[model samples]
Target chain A: MTEKPLLLLSNDDGFDSKGLKELIETLRPMADLIVVAPSGPRSGSSGAITSQVPLRCSLVSEEPGVTVYKCSGTPVDCVKLALNSFVPRMPDMVIGGINHGDNSSVNVHYSGTMGVVIEGCLKGIPSVGFSLCNHAPDADFSATLPYVRRIVANVLAEGLPVGVCLNVNFPDVPDLKGVKVCRQTDGVWASEFAERKHPHGDVYYWMTGVYVNNEPDAPDTDHWALDHGYVAITPTQIDMTAYGQLKRINDWNWNL
Target chain B: MTEKPLLLLSNDDGFDSKGLKELIETLRPMADLIVVAPSGPRSGSSGAITSQVPLRCSLVSEEPGVTVYKCSGTPVDCVKLALNSFVPRMPDMVIGGINHGDNSSVNVHYSGTMGVVIEGCLKGIPSVGFSLCNHAPDADFSATLPYVRRIVANVLAEGLPVGVCLNVNFPDVPDLKGVKVCRQTDGVWASEFAERKHPHGDVYYWMTGVYVNNEPDAPDTDHWALDHGYVAITPTQIDMTAYGQLKRINDWNWNL
Candidate 1:
């Protein structure tokens, strides 16, 4: 009999998120799971590490094949601590999210879910992050189960290359066509802050933004796939180098 | 007069950091500067945003050519807030750091300085982030001033490509050769967490790690340039896509 695969799981949302619960339910049968996630939501912490304070990780639950810990750090910190101290051996695969919202396009750069996935890839582990297009805390994740299971099984069977991970986003619609391997779309958030007066007359602002896609018509982009009600699997990497422009920069005369 | 070109300044270090002050003193004469930085140190806040709370930005000081504000947010937040609300018009260029520590190679992924620079570039403004090899809060930034001046002047004169920005690092050594446009080195932190006992007998851990460079012999990388006492300028971009692997991933049979 084969030993069950050890899977490291985490999410950007707090330990108690509905998304985490659903993910645990979905992956627990196929793997020996260990979950280490933030104590609370750390939504926009993209690959951020906690250097300012010491971290406290407390074991919150332990079952037959599952154990969970709540970490007082960012999503990346959870993975770091798990790999460095918690797990006895290298995990077969590392998975993050089943996140409460979409992490496609420019959202990939601002996602704590992708942060953990990136950290896993940087550590030479096969990793993937799963996010649904829905943003509600109680959003239905029933439609994502089959796709997530298939992807997870595939990644475990076929380990990803070094320095690469997958950013998988499922459309919110019920009638899903299929999965499409795509590239990250060129996009950014056009941010706007809403000003409000405090009780003592001091002013504060809340950040609000719209995701603007620069290449809305690109057929091979993750944004395009999701917009058309298909699951998007974008292979993400740790190398942020723009190799295409390297020659252009090297030719510049830096005589000053 | 060229109306003293507008320059936006920010740092990962707190508003009162010596590096921020030095940056102000160095760039003041050449530009109309507006400073929006965190109220306290926010190191390692790589592209983090404040979605959980409202941000409070208060004016700290004002002068003829300079205005400073302290923000209750991370470095990325400071830049986003400045772009969306504070600046009457988009600044000609955005510059981050004169950082107290190095942001070369893999450090770029974890840098709040680079976070602000990336945000600026995403907004289509020419941007540059400068860091020294020194990590001391009181590290002498005297050697970096000339290089910073030259780089900033060049960036202002020759605007960067639409999605690209600069990540420049200077060595701590005084005897510098020249500047080299380089690629990001392949490197990562081999983290070691120190276990500690709290006063109440609870166990906690502190994250500490040593950066390990995988390719020390690669002379074309930022690590090589900095090790050889030359200023390394790596033109970075907002796109995290691994285009080379796109075709390979697309060939994967998602037969499930």
Candidate 2:
């Protein structure tokens, strides 16, 4: 029989987040689990890596075929360190989040949780990022378990193509409408900065914004699926090359 | 004969980096500049936004047709603020960097310099990021000036397609090898954590590593061009959609 798949888990949320614990519990029995989460929260960290600074990791727990480390770095750093040093072998799959907030549409790029899985896909490992739309720390994952298992098992069963990964987001409802493969929605965060005065009489502006989705009617999109009742699964790739514009760009011909 | 193009400028190397100063000096004569950059360095801060905490900004300098602001955030944040509130109208182009370090190959994904330009492109603005392969704070910009001016003028003379941006990197040398339009070279940063003992006897791991590019022989790659002493110009896009894998992924039929 083939050995169980080694699963590496991580998130932008600190190690104490309930979502992390639940995800660990759910994944522990199924595969060889190794977690490298932040010592403190690192939400919206995106793909930041500590270049000029050194990153520190501390071991908090270990058991048979399972270990946990609290890292002092971004989600991308966590995954890089795990792949380069911590793991005995490159992981069969890398999973991130079961996060507290929505990372469905444009949020994926700004999410440290999703960034690592994206990094994993870049390194040719099968990867998936799971996020619950609700932002409550104690958000329930009871409804998310079956979907996670189904997707992870499917990925394990059917390996992903090179340089591709999955961005899976779940609706907040306890009753799900099952999973739907969708594309990223043309959505963005609209900014509304608030001006405030500090005690020292310094004027400061706070960057505040509300999630304003531009494609509400596009049912084939991740945003539409999650806004409805479905668990949204969007296949994401790392290649940023704009193949369509290559010809026009090539015409620039710097040699001119 | 028309009004000078309104050009938005930013960099990850803070406002003081000589590369940024050179870029500002080079373009100041030809454009109406709106400079917004981080208060301090934010090099590897890719796609990251200031969502959790509020952001603040201060006027750095102002001399008719030119306004520079220093913000307490990453490059992406600066662009977001400018697009949302700080600008009077949409700028003709958004240009980031003359960055002190290289942001070639896979490093583009972890670069705050390129992140701002990507954000600008997503906002439907023509944008480009300029980086010199030299990491020295005082890297010579003479080699970079002609390329930057040429690319910016070209991009301005003919706007980029929606969602298209450029990642331009120059080799740090006095000699010239011309420029090559290329695609992103597949590479990964192999992170090596430096384990250190704190004065209090606590174990800490610092993130450190050099990027070892494996796609050395691939002639059609950015890494190859940079190695051959040619400047690499890669047109980047915001869509992370792996259109090639869409059908195969949908075949999973999550509807089951």
Please provide TM-scores, in order, for all candidate models, with all chains considered together: 0.98, 0.95
> Which predicted model would earn the best lDDT?
1
The parts of candidate 2 lying over 4 Å away from their true place are A253-256, B199-201, B253-256
Model 1 C-alpha lDDT versus the unseen true structure: 0.89
lDDT of each: 0.89, 0.84
DockQ of 1: 0.72
Cα RMSD (Å) per model?
1.3, 1.9
> Each candidate: how many clashes?
0, 4
> What digit string (tens of lDDT, one per residue) describes model 2 on residues A23-63?
88887777989998888888888888887777778788999
The 10 consecutive residues of candidate 1 chain A with the worst lDDT sum are A247-256
TM-score of chain A of each: 0.97, 0.95
Considering only chain B, report the TM-score of model 1: 0.97
Could you give the DockQ of candidate 2?
A: 0.63
Q: What digit string (tens of lDDT, one per residue) describes model 2 on residues B1-256?
A: 7888999989898977888889988998788899998888888999888766778888888999889898888898899887776777899999999888889888888889888898898777999999988878877889778778888889988889887899999887887588778888888766566777889988766766778887899887788888898888888987776667667877784643
Candidate 1 segments exceeding 4 Å error: none
